[model samples]
Target chain A: MEIGAEAIVQNQTPKRAAVTTGADRPGRRPSSGRFRRLNVLVGVLSIPLFIILWELTSRSGIVNMVLFPPPTVVAAAVLEWMRSGQFFWDVAASLYRVTAGFLLGSALGVLLGILTGQFPVVSSLLSPLFQILRPIPPIAFVPIVILWFGLSEAGKLFLVVWGVFFTVWLSTHIGVQKVDRGLIRAALMLGTPRRQMLQEIILLGALPYIVVGLRTAVSISFYTLVAAELAGTFAGVVYRIEIAQQNLQTGQVMGGLAALGLISFIADRLFAALAERTVWWR
Target chain B: MSGYRSTTKLALASSQPSVKTVSEQPAIQVSNLSIVFDTNRGQMIAVDRVSFDVAAGEFVCIVGPSGCGKSTVLNTIAGLEVPFEGEILVEGSPVGHPRPDIGMVFQQPHLFPWKSVRRNIAHGPRMLGKSAKEAGAIADDLIAMIGLKRFADAYPNTLSGGMQQRVAIARALANEPRVLLMDEPFGALDAQTRAVMQDNLLELRDRIKATIVFVTHDIDEAIVLADRVLIMSAGPGRILREIAVNLPRPRSSAILIEPTYLALKRDCLEVIRAEGLRAFNQSDSS
Candidate 1:
């Protein structure tokens, strides 16, 4: 009976192999290639198609032109803003806030994260406090920040820093905790001193996680920037948008929003490129 | 296997004589070593009164079934295991913390992924306060010794399993430790690669004068590598017997076919089978 079963299996094996090989033959190749090409074509046309539809709707009286202006009108307003030279200053102001706040927040986050992750005593003291604060949205603190700083740059910086700090801290903490025990044992066996263990092994082990946290904080800095500007800023992209909104310059307001989105997108991409280099071995 | 036999023969032919010395104190002395872990089921004994002494420049293999606390014994000797009832003296000093004279290789390579092969090897020397130049020189020497000179700058992730294990061994030796502890270092490799690694290790062992204690479940590996093979039984690990392999030096996996080797292997199998049967009966009765 076993021999007969084996014979049946042997007979079916060639048929199964033939069917799979037939499916992989050259006759099926062009359809897959054509499908991939069609996907690329659709992807290339996606943004342009959306813009054209938006423009058509605005101009064809389907929407209020003043409120929902076309992309061309927004572009012209941006060009006008650039011609006046205020665009550069607005970008510089916003860039300065994001950069300063991100650096300060990331530094603090990493420091505290290493402290809490390494020592259980420190973790016991700080983790509970952090857990409480981490869930409260950074935007919610804007009103309180305004009351405290009264439109000062300190308040704006505080908002952005608060937004970035928790993300970086949590990831760094988890990363340090998740560092392989085998690696630690190996390092210990190699006579790695306690101080050097933290500096060399622990820090580098947690770096990949820290980079991930910092990347997340990049987008978060933009989110908090919105809150900070709305709270009250002298000059920033969001501030310009607010001013345009009040003056009823809908095109300028739309242009400001576009500029903000572009900056955030660029920041995310730049950090992603940097992150790849940061964890170079990956 | 046949391809590596020639290289093994060549390595043995060119290898220097063993530097085994009759020093006053043994390289490692473990007396009455016991470890207890507080698991969900009250307290469980991991190692029970395990005692052994490895002589200077001696190669010893501890062979046992999995969860036999053989690794725990190795770790305790390396000063990585704590809160255990034991007196482990390495070179006449009681083991408490990881010392510079001791080096260990784990089951996994555990090579710092961020570091290149050269840098990973240099890490031990650098931590010991050797200057970058000195550390680099040491790393380069070991890299050449391991025959991975071409891949000195390559990262661990890029290397094959056997190659990574070689680098790991080189890294452990970078400090020129007096005693080296290895816990199933080639257990993760395929059989073919494992044979090659064993041959490479035998060749490398000829040059380095460090006392080595290797742990494995493979009786064949233990016999091929060690001057003394310590057989251990699990369920609160304890040594069952110690068999001395009187095989000639500069040996490799090629000796598996030899009459004396087969006799020694039969002895080890009888001991292990008796232990396994006893444990099986005890568990069944329970």
Candidate 2:
């Protein structure tokens, strides 16, 4: 009996090994960590290529160096501005306006968007007004904004708020509207109360869209920020660019434009990073 | 014949107590329930005066054709849909709105993609004002019960379709509801996975003893799981017939091969076949 049991076990071992190998062969699993590292490498490689192209274009004189400065020259300007703390002030001012307006507008937009999405009558009544208003550019509002509120911080801030608000609002509305009906039913059946449904179901369902909207609006914030400071400000990066233009300081003008581009790029990258961390669940 | 007589004796014994107290209510009393949907063509009746009493801890299956309103009845019971006429009473109270006393599992897993398996299971308690710690305990217990303890922290997207639906089942049971409404929960899974799920469901039902109202179009599924099967008509859905399964307790996939189980399955298929053929003929005439 013992010898027979041992023979059976020995036969099964090879059979089990064969079966396991056959199963593994069908679905060839690759390591995900390698794919992620490859993506990061591709992104890092693009930065140097961009700088090399900028230097080549400037050296070739295809476009005036005054109009489009080389990346090295812009790097030098960045260093000079950094040492003098002029870069710090410009960054601080821009960040302050964008952050404040973005927060205020987003909060209101999210609230109203959720309401309109949930309530049919509210959505019907408010959708048309928003649809008409959304198409009107934030920059177009600059003249009227200045006339109404003056060229003070309020005027610029209002434009930024308006810009971020509609984007966030529209995305949020779409998000809530498109939430899976089945999931809602599942939640309801599980005894999720009506008042808590928005936070538990609606907001969570709309999170991915909200993140996308917020990230997109970061670029809009920069747009409104630049336009806001261009006409009225005695300070700000745009104002400094205007000063350089008036003085006919080609390098400084290019430098200021480069600074704006650099700041916009950094802001976009920051938003992307924040979105990745916050919306891992999404 | 002996089994039938025994079932009749059991029914009589149960009803004898009710004779003294006819006014006493069932755990779930669905009476004259009808649901109508307004379409471009006209008013369509989905459920037509479907009345049934689900005694506490009874395992019932609502079986019918694909278009039959078995799911609609479950929805009405769950308080997700308001019946056009009649009413549903749960524990002597009319079900006017959704409450946690009833839990539901859908055909699709419907687990939140973002939450881990554990978090999805815990969502019910979290919503019910339980502390995170308390909810976590319930979640852990349920995850273990579903044999998914290893995958508790894994996201729903990372799991297979069967695993996702298993998580959904665990999530529903996490609240420890009195009545569990399952709308073709195994319908989305492959044949092998579905067999495993059916066995798991029977085991869970035996252990938990929660009143289950399962909806399915598969006759074999109806035979294997249900203590009683309610067959429904299509379109304006209504309970056409009720058949007691009367199979032995503690059923598993092997029960399918039993002679009595096969006979009952054939009986169910004949009824569904008649309804299906009738529907086809009517549609053809139109």
Candidate 3:
């Protein structure tokens, strides 16, 4: 023990001397600092500069003004949307569909995933059926959903849930299967019963992969929402966009696109925050 | 193989009284144990007709090179693996699936990431039908025993490798198993941590009553901790020789520098060297 402490003390002396002398070569320091500040300045200007360029081009008539609306025109359309009551319904309807579909799909996916991943017999029964259906895009089912439910909320929810289910299921299945063998052996020796193994070891071991699956499904849920609303809906962001396009309300179309992008972005950010807390140990 | 160093010469003077009553019964007995695996290439023999008995409260170390099947033997005793040719008895019953009375510490700590140090140690007790309060008390005592009281609430990722292994050991002991099997528990640690863990294990072993069977590839570790060292040869692994280490107790890493310890190490190494040469010649001739 004394020898180990002496060795560490000896290692510290040279490190302390190096830290006291700031720059080993002074010539390269200032240029590197300037480049880093320049990079940040350019990054801050990128979006505003693009907006200004679009305004100039639209006003200058470089392209047809009817088709190429600028940011200012889009903002005005958004303000008009807020003045009416429909925007609230549009946002609420879309948020509700995304939230409801995500929860239902994720619950079913995770439960079945755990069953199939942990049990060979369950995998043999369900994995093939899921595998066959998983490759079919949820958007491709819009026609069938319309025929089955005729633009009801159930049809919309079904599409969004379909988009989410497969991604979550496959990831959870792989995660459960890939859980370290050493962990199971250790748990077995510690007297963990087969029934309790799921709660005790498997779920927590596979949590990181499950969180990743859910994060991906968040974006996928939004995509299926667009398909569902576009197929047919009374009041939704994507439905509004479709209505404005038919009337050639180009500014409103652009505004709806921005709103959809913003909401999906925020949902993704929120899920990312939740994911960090879920796997807190990492 | 040296009769002059018969275990009785040192077992008589040892301060550890358990050494005197070693004949109480075999805590673990393996008679003609063999393990064979079927691979794509054909069948392979892992352990071939090997047998040994671990006396109650005895600390036996199985030393060998990699793939010597020493760990396979230990795993079979713990009921993690099965032997095809021979039967194993732990206390008087035939071996099967993992029983609550036999504990194992693997090479990796394998601490549950979601669990705090205390919860990890308490898991075994809770599974055995202990109440929450009773389990918490057991976990607290072990947290103090392993000297990790401050880390009781900390999760596994926050711990150092040595600290995690200490918790794993504590967790195995929480069940108070009659037999403790360790498969190179300190093999993954660095040299300094390995030495420190070895010393700590020595101290911890004296306080616990579980009969220990530790498997390691390192000869020094085997000599430092074992009452009897079982040297094994690789490729259809078999016990090559048994060296009864009559070394005194209250021993530590300091024994590595002692003249007597050096002589004992020499004897174990010579046996291993001869076994290696025999295997090499056989493989070449075949």
From the highest DockQ down, the ranking of the candidates is: 3, 1, 2
List candidate 2 stretches off by more than 4 Å: A1-85, B1-25
CA lDDT of A171 in candidate 2?
Answer: 90
Error of 1 at B189 (Å): 0.7
- Candidate 1, DockQ score (0 to 1): 0.46
Per-model RMSD to reference: 5.2, 7.6, 5.1
Worst 10 residues of 1 chain B by lDDT: B1-10
Query: Per-residue alpha-carbon lDDT of model 2 for A75-138, expressed as tens digits?
Result: 7766787799887787688778888988888887888888888899999999999999999988
Q: Largest lDDT belongs to which candidate?
A: 1
Q: Higher lDDT: candidate 1 or 3?
A: 1
Question: Better model by TM-score, 1 or 2?
Answer: 1
lDDT string for model 2 (B1-286, tens) is: 0123234444444444321233345678988998889989998888888899988777889988777888888888888887468988987788867789888999998988778998898899988889999999999877877777779899888888888888999999988898899999999877777888898887667556467889998878888888789999898798878999888866788888999988888888788788889888999999
Give the Å error, residue A126, model 1: 0.7
- Residue-wise C-alpha lDDT for candidate 3, range B1-286, written one tens digit per residue: 1122323443443456775475656998889999998989998999998999989988999999999889888888888885367989999898888988999999999998888999999999999999999999999878877788779999999888889999999999999999999999999988888998999888777677788999999999999999999999998999889999888888999999999999999999899999989999999999
Assess each prediction's global lDDT (C-alpha) against the native: 0.91, 0.82, 0.90
For model 3, what is the alpha-carbon lDDT of residue B58? 89
> Which tens-of-lDDT digit does each residue in A76-167 have in candidate 3?
99999989978999999999999999999999889999999999999999999999999999999999999999989999999999999999
Deviation in Å, model 3, residue A249 alpha carbon: 0.8
TM-score of chain B of each: 0.94, 0.89, 0.93
Ranking by lDDT: 1, 3, 2
